[model samples]
Target: MSFAEPSRIEPDDNQSRGIALAILLLPLTLPLFLFLCLFVFLPVGLFAFLFSFTGELLFYLSMWNDGRTLTRRRLRRRLAAGETGTLIIEYPMLAQGRTHAWWTPDDISTLAPLPIPDRSSDEYQDAVLDLMEQDQSHPWDAWCWQEYTSTSQGKASLLRVWNGKKYQEWLARHYPSIPIVETTSEIVRQLEIEAQQKSHQPQP
Candidate 1:
């Protein structure tokens, strides 16, 4: 299945913060180094300069690599081959903090799609009420259209489509066979429980 036009996923807030900090520190390194060289110790000054420069260089490289271009390319090829698997795009928070794995076709019978709850559903309404009652913020409270699950070797893997408008459109068009059925966090919790149970079961 073809993916929606690859929209560039930006680095997360933590990464952006790190990049900004690095940029701010980079200029100070030279002045600090110069002061150290003139006053206290040449080695200390050199260390300070090298440390700041290297840190910034590494941060920039990391930001560049986190773009996910390579992963998307690989995922497209795999999808075309009818491989139902999870593509972990690190830059996005779509998966809601779960271990990521891509299962081979031999690993599971099929990928089951879990539909997001509609506004009218009692479950959705209850969740909203709970949110107001608790008055607490949750990142995962955002609406998600569906979740895909696959099981292999007694373990379950959860997958969510990357949150890109174009990408969701592409999935709808290309993978209509994938049914969208209502699901909730309870389903994911159940899968985790089942996997744990399986793991604890003694092997023959």
Candidate 2:
């Protein structure tokens, strides 16, 4: 929950003439700035209006499935608290977000890819800005995950990143406990082998 001393991320307001602006101006600017992700699941949220429990259940289930050995919220939260685990993920992409895999701690279990949108796009920038404007805030990864949950991602993922130098530096400084590796064909191959081995084991 604690952040680095700087906690440098601040909400951006390119239009900060006065507070009165939001009362009237936000509606005017909103349509121009709204991104695809915001409205993409508009109906889903409407559906939740009828059965909110179903939406909450799906979101939590998504979190648990993506957790270590299939439980908890996220791997990085543990790493943030100084827990050690080799956190494997798709090779960091310049634009698109990356899928994640965290297995038996120093030991691993599942391997799969989750689809995500490009982080470097204008749509993403606007989406993040809109989320921040609403005071929907969390640490970077958690914030992104919150956005991801709104859509069909919950149906596919237990789980699901940024640029190279900036992204790597951020991860290293923020989470030093885990060895975060980009996936290579060889690494993916090994995980596949492990999955096959586990599949043959007697079920508890």
Candidate 3:
């Protein structure tokens, strides 16, 4: 299926979120300032305010740079009919480095939708609660779909669809032949099996 126009993929502004966070935390310095004014000398109070402001600014700037690095996007060419090349899919995470997988046109088996799990599912609810407890932020809104591919070498993840609902819908419409699965775990299991097989292979 042909890809939508390049303009359709809205580029994320990486700095905006960091700036908002910094602004939200800026008020926290006021308490430190007050504390200093009540017990410390005037010169010491002024120094503390400057030090706190500078530290806060630096912390946010560091976060902004890291966010920019993780969310950076590059222009990708649309796949044409009979085209054969490597298609790379990236998974960006906040606590860990980004990971990627690749597949060629021949290796792809099907494209599947990855729906958000129902809130009633205990596993899903627990995962959400765990994230909340950790107080960590995430870059992804939702995992929209996945591309499953296989070869004699074994199965591999061809692509991970994120923030691409429209693109996924267009693909589903144009490529009616590809079977769409509902969950990601099945494909993940296939990948794990592949990894096990590869690990067991004798040294060349």
Question: lDDT for every model?
Answer: 0.43, 0.42, 0.40
- Give the per-residue lDDT digits (tens) of candidate 2, residues 19-137: 66677788878775665437656667777665645543564465565541332345457655666544444332222443343222442212223333344557645664565566442
Model 2, position 100: C-alpha lDDT score: 42
In TM-score terms, candidate 2 sits at 0.25
Q: Write the per-residue lDDT of candidate 1 for residues 78-146, one digit (tens) a residue.
A: 778877633222111222332222222332124322343453466665665566466431222221212
Candidate 1 — number of clashing residue pairs? 1
**Candidate 3: what lDDT?**
0.40
For candidate 3, write residues 110-172 as lDDT tens digits.
332334344346675466446546652111112222233222322333332233233334445
Model 1 / residue 107 / CA error / Å: 11
Candidate 3: worst-modelled 10 consecutive residues by lDDT = 137-146
Clashing pairs in 1: 115-181
